[model samples]
Target: MTEENLNTSGNPSIQDVVEQRLSRRGMLRMGVGTAGAAVLGSLSLAACGGGGDDVAAAPAPAPSTTPISLNFPAVAKSTADLVTVPAGYTATVLYALGDPLNAATPDYRNDGTDTNFETRAGDHHDGIDYFGLNAAGTARDVAGSERGILVMNHEALTDQFLHAAGVTANPRPAAEADKEIPAHGVSCVEVRKVNGRFVYQRESQYNRRITPNTPIEMRGPVRGNALLRTKYSPAGTDTRGTINNCGSSVTPWGTFLTGEENWSGYFARSATDDTARGGATAKSVVSLARYGRPQNSASRHGWETAGAADLYARWNISQTGTSTDGTDDYRNEMNTYGYMVEVDAYAPAAAARKRTALGRFAHEMGMFGLAQAGKPLAVYMGDDSRGEYIYKFVSTASWDAADASPANRMAAGDKYLDAGRLYAARFNADGSGQWIELTIANTTIANFANYRFADQADVLVNARLAADAVGATKMDRPEWAAVHPVTGEVYVTLTNNSNRKIEASGSGQQSVDAANPRAYTDAPTAATAPGNVNGHIIRFRETGNEPAATTFAWDVYLFGAEAGMDATRVNLSALTADNDLSSPDGIWFSRKTGLVFVQTDDGAYTDVTNCMMLIGKPGQVGDGAVQALEYTKADGSKLTVNARVGAKPTSATLRRFLVGPKDCEITGITETPDGKAIFVNIQHPGETIAKANIGDATKFLSHWPGNAGYGAGGALARPRSATIVITRNDGGLIGTDGTQVLNGY
Candidate 1:
């Protein structure tokens, strides 16, 4: 979420594995069902608002088997301050930041005067999932295409725009902190198709906001552990709120899993805190440094400096009280974060649970694999940092079809998510990869020299260390992932990495590896952005078509490059003007049409166009041959990497769908059951406004939807993060002719 690269781990880079050149390999067995979308199969679950045990369940319509193809013309790339879709499609604003959810709440006055964000729409909408509602709008209806509930994560904020004249300096005012803290969690809003368009319900009973002040239970092996003890919860059984919620996942039983990312920056540590905790060699001290919270680090929002109230004081991780067990101070407050928080949207009164068995480390997206009738479930995740590793957690209990529409969804999460085996990925030069288990029983982790493991709880709480001990392959900022609906192969987006170097720039700098094979800068805006200026997407198929497989085959699915880049080197995917993109961040596959959507959060290619989203038809892994790319090192040495890449993309296969306004990122998209409409979130428009010029709208980078006539119009409107619904004029399926799907693969 933060543009700054915070990874200091000197683990072996993907370039290290490419140099081996062991041997070529075959593709793994892909699954028969879908990952996130259609894996629910024929089972249908009601939307939120249905009582826990009274919700009705139905079956969904079968997916279309028509061949995949792009039906509409591609929209030309634009730098204009509005969402640009194809000619036949219409984009309508559905929900915006600070929009009131209750009838008692006043309408949003977008000029930074809004309050009680706990009852309003949060900022920076990220990953989202659509839960369909019945025609009556009271319960979930997997078959209901006209209405549903959208559960989305509010990742972070553009603080400069939160107040009337930007944020106060140093010792921040509690008033400013009060509004920002509640805007950083997740929101659940009910939306319906009204008179041929989708609009959010202002007074739906299912609507709720899960802020940092909400009550959440700590579940799994790490619950009640001493490391989680703090003044707020001496028993360590519960914690207050979830912060920096990023990308999300929807379970087969209809629960939402929100990832906690970039949370380490919110805790302020005193310069002498390491000494207070018994020296730098202490286990707690080592963990603090490893998680990027070294001594003297300042809090991100200065919430800790806003008086001594527990709400503000909890942000400070300094040991101030006299108690030795951290029961009297907030020393262990940071430990309560960074895990996946599961929310039952159907049950508004239920407390969200932090599932710790999944492990914690700047989690980006927790993607589920194909859910079978009686097989173990698997969740794939990325750490979302420079030189971080990909991980997967396989549940110990096998899946039961009855749990698909359980009376109590959180109870089902307890059965599957509470106990699991976590594994880190290691890519081989020969196009093969292995998933190394991260458990206390593993000799490599149990006898790690860097940090000794006390038990399974310690291994999971400090998962990065266990991953490092096993020599996992470091990637280029892996963010969001998507699994194919038919083929079942997993695709992960490796967003650009500025820390990547042709030759080592410093002790922890990463070099070009086989997996991350590019280290070139683009002309114009990205001239200074060397080392994979435009990121790429890599996909792999699990061995034996099983989510719990330990071995798999992988290849670069698509390379993120400019249309004019060198084809033999940087433009490895053979991209054209219509399909070229940069820094692929959010990704998802349409269960109805089998089309994968790619969104960007980039600074590398902004000179030519604003960030955009693209739609494409994906092919299976190992569909292309391995290519050799040569690069010159800093010392005048030549380096060659044999990168296994997938099939080339064409105008027919991949094309830009929508381009966002200035200084904003195109993120979080989901479609209706019939694929007739798609909801997209536009985040942080005009975010480049300087702190001194916050109240001056003329100096704002972009006016966005407001200037385009959605909310408060005119030249003085402040840009607000909002959601838009896209639908075809002819009432056809999105990106396709209603009766037929895309014509190309």
Candidate 2:
């Protein structure tokens, strides 16, 4: 459906649209921390120096065998039936939504009568990472290791089913809404496999939840800016919590970096206040607008009107005091979020920090490349919105192999994150891209007519403004970026956006360019409206395939579509049910196994089945020929091109491994280097399960990770966001052959 024809009632408004544009679309047919150097000064220094000397050697390469075949049998349509995998494979649920976060709290009741969410694991787990541990319980790299710490992101909650009684659109008592806030954050769970079965260490000291209540420090250029000075921290040195943490990355030094995305919609702002504060400037207007905190805008949960509790008041972004001073007001509270938060998963005592140097925006996730001591570090990130820009952060300091020690972990982050240059991606029409630096004093950004900048903080906080000033190339919604294992080339998923059209002459805000070639009207489908629907995956190889290179060559890797969509464009890959998917999001490449995992969050195909994940052995870059793409630009001129894209995957090389339940997303993947076991997260299963019906097991849409039989109650009894373990049943390599083998190859 065209944007004009779509209804906008319950739909987010323009302001929310700005915030979510980078995040929202399916293949449419038609469609860290600091701390305590003093107390244990001796202990700290000793631990730091001691661990640095013990660099573990890389594990021996696993024996190479014939490629494994992959295929699956469709099971029951609705019930959470065990996935029919190749005969030698097994899948087990490791952790599920609502599991207790601490040993001190009561375990999950699964009966839907429990309400103590303060200590429970959050719902809708998203991005995650696996950190192997040494035999001594310290974090280390262990090849073929079964024991490690799995740090997972609890992106957000599906509040509709979080409580015993369904939540009212307009609730009377605000306390009912208060409980859900604390449950949204990151969960660091320590897990290990014993006797070939994965199990979480419930009492592990490292098991901790970093929630909205956790105190976090602000770091980088924007540290003490007036914009971040919320009442929670009058000095702007600290903030209460992190929100909307979607995807994440793990550092070589053993810390977790969770990205805060879509954090703007949580607060209530006054429209008049925003207009009065020089919000007309592109920096101010776009900042507030992009974040969805327009003045007078209401919150989805209405927490701001809930009373005098600091907890509720914190959600208010309205300017309350008469003075222009921001102390009593929250004009800048929203700014405190939308950052990359660094959390020490192992050190519960350490507070997390918002690494402002990364540049605040709708951050999807950060991915790092191989590290060398004393060498500059490189990180790749996506803005997660349509028409937004992609970014990379290159650390100023060289890596120090010694920094991997437990004691120097935070120092390692500081060494790398403290002072770094941030650059935005500009994909040219000639299959090449450049990284434009967003520095204030040394560039055209400082001389922009609109916003005045005093230092780097302004440029970092108002990065979009700077990018605009310098004229960076706008992209389709960029999400979940990863570096190719065999080649250091980077790939980003530009999920579909219906608003995009092909521009002929003059450029429009999101006019289609060579980089984003496809532009067409989506056909009416069962689950999706007719508009620009099915999206495509874009891959770029840095000059010479070097992760640290500032220039790169790119191409469209895959175009998503229905099994029988347009043969010319829609079905760019000629994909079948075995591998076709819309709105590709969570993506990862296993460096050790050279396996590319693709996950989908599609409304377009929901009429057929739930979201799914697929595995592919992608061919090397430059493996395909150029193809012609046609579209109509905003200027009403038609544009056509013959551009190169990734080779299409045959059914034999790519296939769906699993599908999620009602209203759920299949995301957050990590695998052992050996490829023996894969960890996948199912987020918000049965998300539509009404609160009133939560007590009735049969009424719930899903009871996954629990036993397949009826009424097998336990932790998994409740429909929850959870992580599952998939392994070969016969204790052999996964996807070893080109055909369906293990089961009966």
Give lDDT tens digits, candidate 2, residues 443-561: 68889765676678888887766776767766667778876532445678876666455542222235556676666655444224223477778887666434457898788778777
List candidate 1 segments past 4 Å from native.
3-5, 15-66, 523-529, 738-745
- In the range 1-745, model 1's lDDT, one tens digit per residue, is 5534355666777711110110000011111122222111232211111101112322332344334468878878888888899899999889988889999889887878778899999999888887878999887776567888899999899888778888898798999999999998999999988887788999999999999999899999999999889998999889999988878878767788888988989889999999998899888898888888889999999999998899999999988888978999999989899898899887899999999999989888788776766678888898888888899999999887677677898999999999989999999888999999999999999999889999999998999889989989888898887766544678899998877777657855787787888888777645775777888899998887677899998999899988898999888989888989999999887765667899999888888889999998777778778999888876798898888888887898889999999889988888776677888999999888788798678888888778877776555678888899999998878886422221110
lDDT of 2 at 536: 76
TM-score, every prediction = 0.93, 0.85
Residue 263 lDDT (model 2): 74
lDDT of 1 at 238: 90
Task: Provide the lDDT at 448 for model 2.
Answer: 72
